[model samples]
Target: MKKEKTIETINPTTGKSLHHYSYMSDEAVKKAISKCHKAFETWKEISPKDRAKIILSIGKELIKSKEELAQLMTDEMGKTLEQSRQEVDLCVAICNYTAKIGPKELKTEDREMVNDNKGRITYAPIGVVYGIQPWNYPSYQVVRYSIASLMAGNGVLLKHASNVTGSGKLLEQIYQKTDIPDGLFTVLVINHDQSDTVITNKLVRGVTLTGSPDAGKNIGQKASAALKKSVLELGSNDAYLVFEDADINLAVKACVKGRIYNNGETCIAAKRFIVVEKVYDEFRDKFVEAMSNVKTGNPNIKSTQLGPIAREDLRNELHQQVVESVKKGAKIACGGKIPNGNGFFYPATVLENVKPGQPAYEDELFGPVASLIKAKNNKDAMRIANDSRFGLGGGIFSKNEEAAFEIAEKYFDTGMVFINSFGLADPAMPFGGVKESGYGREHGGFGLKEFVNIKSVMYR
Candidate 1:
């Protein structure tokens, strides 16, 4: 008999293993997919309103276990307990919002065809949707796609990041407590090879992933080969522009929040700060001072602003990016050194003199690191912001709301733009990107239709 491989979840704050899960066997994976598809057969036939009711009850289950799940998330991924709670809050909101709007969003529409014929457009569920989510904001990441898919009448499958396997399992448990049928939301504790096999499974219909561009490419290719639709929310080196007419205080505060939120591991968080020359000096000094004040410690503590890097290898990779950027002419304004510690902790860092060739300017530093770039003027700032392969999200700060909106609408080429404040995903807004950041929209009712088949029914 062969020994089964296992995936271990670690406590990023203590550098200790928290839990381990055995990888599902190929037979088990196949069975799970078949079971989910079997459930989808009945799930799809249920009315959207009935599906929404079941989906909304999942929120109640989540709230019941909010504290335990939040602790599990913090212990696994090193986000502060407060942030972990907030993640759960967002998940709950997702369930509530999905339930509120899903029936209407999925409602059949009537249209008039040529020659006075009647046409009906139906949004039908495809089948099982496989979601590959990241560790940061573990709960929200899982719920963001899962709830919408559930409301759309598709069975949900999750291959969550191995580092946060515990959170994924907990979510499965929560879903089981709901009235949803068994296997409707299955968590596959499997390795990369098994995941690929699952993607090619005939029972699986569509795929969605929130990971790096490289990972997206691999998964997207596999899905394409299988003739399955995929939604990839890839990486981004998002910029927050500080224009000449911006409020220096407001910009600095929001920029710091944008850079360090989720310990700066967020795909959409501001990684680059593009400031006009008129206010570069002031913004840099203030931003660095505020970031320097951020304390890195145990995520269980409420006052801690930044946590560990979620894994030691991730911390090392982030440090290497910082070192290479420095060697390439970017200067560390504050907090560049890797501290001697028990956990995978990296300090909140800001890089100045950031140029195009440096990693600080070129790559997505997936930790609490900030890149400060100076632009000649407001127009130059917009140009600098759009100068990236990533177009997920960006921010523009100006006291003039109309001008800021104009810049975001017309000039910022990303999928989402923040006018003044920094925020993560909202349940009501469309979230996704263009170019290398991946395509297809999630949230804001857009996600409900992502995996649905829009069929046109005509009557003569």
Candidate 2:
């Protein structure tokens, strides 16, 4: 496939052109990689404490430009302005968290050898790590990996989604405002083929991606074939289980927030709501009512609860999923309609009688659409939650905290689980998923080591 010469970003809210960017040529990308590798030579020698100092400054810079950055993300990807601000806040939190723990996490450790010789383990910075990120949570997705990798002394490169190209360039500018080196945190405005060339570059040591499973497979394969390490945080159809003993009101409220937050374009958003037969009718009634009342309109408005779907094609794809699911016997209790308007708006939809062999039940509906599945009992609810091929994160809502914890730990078959709440990534806690949702973890000090070379040295 031939690489395009230019990339254009459109405003999803208005469907108008916001900016046009020229893709970096192959020579430009190679030079960028070489520059990053050169910077890495000096950056890798810096102490973790010094790196944390710069990272701390980055957090301050992010807050200083929070409003501007937030608005740019809103204009680029159709996320609500307030949500964009919150995304900036999350990025700041990640920066703060990475700075606080990075020094200790990346510090060298002394250990005893088998023959009683002195042994030391050093977590050294690898070369430039390339990240291919999605448009959803643009700031958070970039900051999530870049901050940790920078703190670990590795140079960072980004290939942000084309729809959020402005966000990516703005982030690069934000990083430049801090003490970070020039090429240490660079954003490549290149297409897919150039990205492949980057992965094969000898200067690129590690790769990480946050996208769909198919994308993960492609990048993972390329990185593996090149013998470079990769970390993937793929998509998920996270289930929010409402057990028989669960509080119907609390479950409904949290599930609704989980589904609709970020306009329901989140990777870990509660897509599946599995309710026990005992309380299915009551929960379904209240859930459908809440979803029906959700406001959908311009993202800039303060009162809008749902924004445009980021792109026209994405909205159309979501509608097709709803249509296919309906054909497979799923019934739309509320929403499920694409609005006849200028913007790519998808209503907060709910599908009931959701069963296997339906897109609503099998695959991820990456929008404000909910799949309400009925389980015979608590055991059956667990079974349905664990039935999917993707296992990123899930939730177990029950009044008995202990029982929910046990389920989260023992039976959930996911990376992270919420007991009585619906929450996204936390800087203090480890985040990532298992199975097709992608391997490896991010956040909570775990991400700091993902791109580091753990070297062992012995002295006799």
Candidate 3:
């Protein structure tokens, strides 16, 4: 297997060089998987309590090393240092959440199997599990799969995003430094060829991917060809709906967090804001002012709220998307064009008069760009929000709590929704999408199940 000395990792914030990592080869990937399989043998023999102890130990180590991990992520992918730190924190919380609680959560029902038998459902390992994670939320995506896979007695093979090779390496460092068993978790430095081999390996019983729909389809199909269970979390065009009765200030703030958090690179970020026509002007004014106030620059500093697009092409692509949207008649309120500077920075842009026919109406914009749509009323807002094929998450702001829940029920494909607030993430909640946003969840109990098998045992 061939490997490189290093892949160029540029800081999107200032276009500075942040050197780290060479890609691993197909042979390396295979070897790593073999190691994972070997570890799984011994790891599976350990009690869930013991595994929990190891996991909790890893969490404690994470807390101690949080700053270094966060700084490494910032250097790797150029998100704000604070954001990178937060991503590390999210990983720590996940490790803590899954470790302290997973052993009990995996417990089965103690019931008789009817007149002559005892029955119980057991959560068991499914061999080595392969996780193909993306660049956005690097640590979060890694934890989303790794924590559960480790907790459920399975080994893990990680093939993280290419742009985030440093992050992948950093993860390897963190897990390796902790008490967590060595081969139970391995981050493959290998490229897709190795990733492909790992996916098809007999040792890998299951695979989960957090990427694009096309990538998900290809990986999913390959996994199916190998007869492996797979979970796909593609992308989304999540909507943020605001009603006439909603709190403008709060809704506007949440909307900013939803869209601008992670520099608007989240799959669950609010892509479209469907607002009631009665308050469209107010919402637009406030949203534009807020977006304009957002500062996009150095990721290592404390005051920077938004950073660069993770990569240069991504920034160019986002600029093109906005330019194309404007050509299709979507008005740019505050930050329409790229800032007159170098590096991959696109000022937060707002799209007004975004309609069904507009290009921005259809796809996910992976930067600090958001589209605003006007609706006649609650029903109209619902109609607009539900108009897209992707339904990963959503938000609705209404004074009426019952009305918010009622409206929430009306959203057929939404996995998570925020009422009178913004859509954010929680380790306790199940997160995923429907339609093009992809199927399956990546957090909480459901997330744990994605990498395991449910075995029903019975005895007379």
Candidate 4:
């Protein structure tokens, strides 16, 4: 008999183990894929209206267990209880939005054809969809892909980050409570090798992932080699531009939240700050002061504004980035050192005089560290914002809303843009990125179509 491998889920708040899950064996993984393929056969036969009904019921189940799910997320990951609750709320909202619009989005349409022929276009379900999600916003990331695939009449297979295995299982339990068919959604506790096997399986017709760009590339290549469709939501060092006419106070507040939200582990979190020369000094001072004052402690506490990094290695990696950036001429404005504590704690940090050659300027510093760059003017600031290989999401703070909108629409080379605020994903809006941030989109009405086949039938 082969020895079973186990994954220990550790709580970042206390650096303690919360749970242990035995990894699924290769045989079990293959069985799960077979089960998902079986479920998809039935799921695809269901009407879109019926699928929407089940999806809406899943939303209600999520709301019923919001508090418990939120606690699980906080215990497994380092997000605050408030933020975890918000993540569950967002998942519920995604379910609700997809339920409302999915039927219409999947309905067959009659189209005009040439030569006196009538044509009908139909959205048909593909086979099973495989998703590889990360630990940050555990619930949201899983739901962001699963719900849309479900509504589109496809089965879902989730390979959640090992750190959040319990959260992933809880999500599966919640789905089971709904009227969803058995095996419709399965969470496989498997390793990277198993994931590669699943991706290459003929049963999995499509793939979607939310993770680093490097991971995206590997998965994209695997899916491409298999002749499968994929949608990737990858990483970015998102920048926020502070124009000369921008409101400094609002910008400071938004940037603070943007930089540290989710312990600064979010793909779209603001990492780079480009402030015009007219407001650089004042903006830098206030931003550094606010970031320095942020309280990092137990995520469960209501007063805690920041929390520890999700793991010790992640904390160490962030510090290395700060140290290397400083060695390359970036100056530490505040909070550069690691705090003495039991957990993986790094104080909220800000780096000034950031230049192109520094890691703080060139790479995604996946932690609560902000890189401040000065621009000569609005145009220069915009140039600096678009200088990165990543184009996931960005912001522009300007007094004139019209001007900001124009720039966001015409020039901001990002998937999503915030005019005067630092916001996270919205269910009503298309979310994804261009360039190295990965291709394809999720949310709004676009995601339901990502895994569906748009077929056309013509008849005289």
Each model's lDDT: 0.93, 0.92, 0.83, 0.94
lDDT per residue as tens, model 2, 1-460: 6656788999988889999999997899999989888888888888999999999999999999999999999999898999999999999999888899999998889999889899999998888999999999889999999998999999999999998999999999999998777788999999887899999999999999999999999999999999999999999999999988888999999999999999899999999999999999999999999999999888999998889998898888889999999999999999988778687889999999898999999999999999999999999999999999999989998989998898888899999999889999999999899999999989988998888889999998
Q: TM-score for candidate 2, please give it.
A: 0.99
Q: Write the per-residue lDDT of candidate 4 for residues 1-460, one digit (tens) a residue.
A: 5655899999988898998899998999999999989998998999999999999999999999999999999888889999999999999999999999999999999998987899999999998999999998889999999999999999999999999999999999999999888899999999898899999998999999899989999999999999999999999999999999999999999999999999999999999999999999999999999998999999999998888898888888999999999999999999999888688888899999999999999999999999999999999998999999999999999999999999999999999999999989999999999999999989989999999999999998
Model 2 Cα displacement at 398 (Å)? Answer: 0.5
- Which regions in candidate 4 have their CA more than 4 angstroms from the true location? 1-4
Say which prediction, candidate 2 or candidate 3, comes out ahead on TM-score: 2
Question: Per-residue error at 46 for model 3, in Å?
Answer: 0.9
Give the lowest summed-lDDT range of ten residues in model 4.
1-10
Residue runs of model 1 more than 4 Å from their true location after superposition: 1-4
Which ten-residue region of model 3 has the weakest summed lDDT? 1-10
Ranking by lDDT: 4, 1, 2, 3
Sliding window of 10 residues with minimal summed lDDT for model 2: 1-10
- The global Cα lDDT (0 to 1) of model 4 is 0.94
Candidate 2 off by > 4 Å: 1-3
- Per the 3 Å backbone cut-off, how many clashing residue pairs does candidate 2 have? 0
lDDT of candidate 1 over 5-57, digit per residue (tens): 88888898888888878888889999999999999898999999999999989
TM-score of 1: 0.99
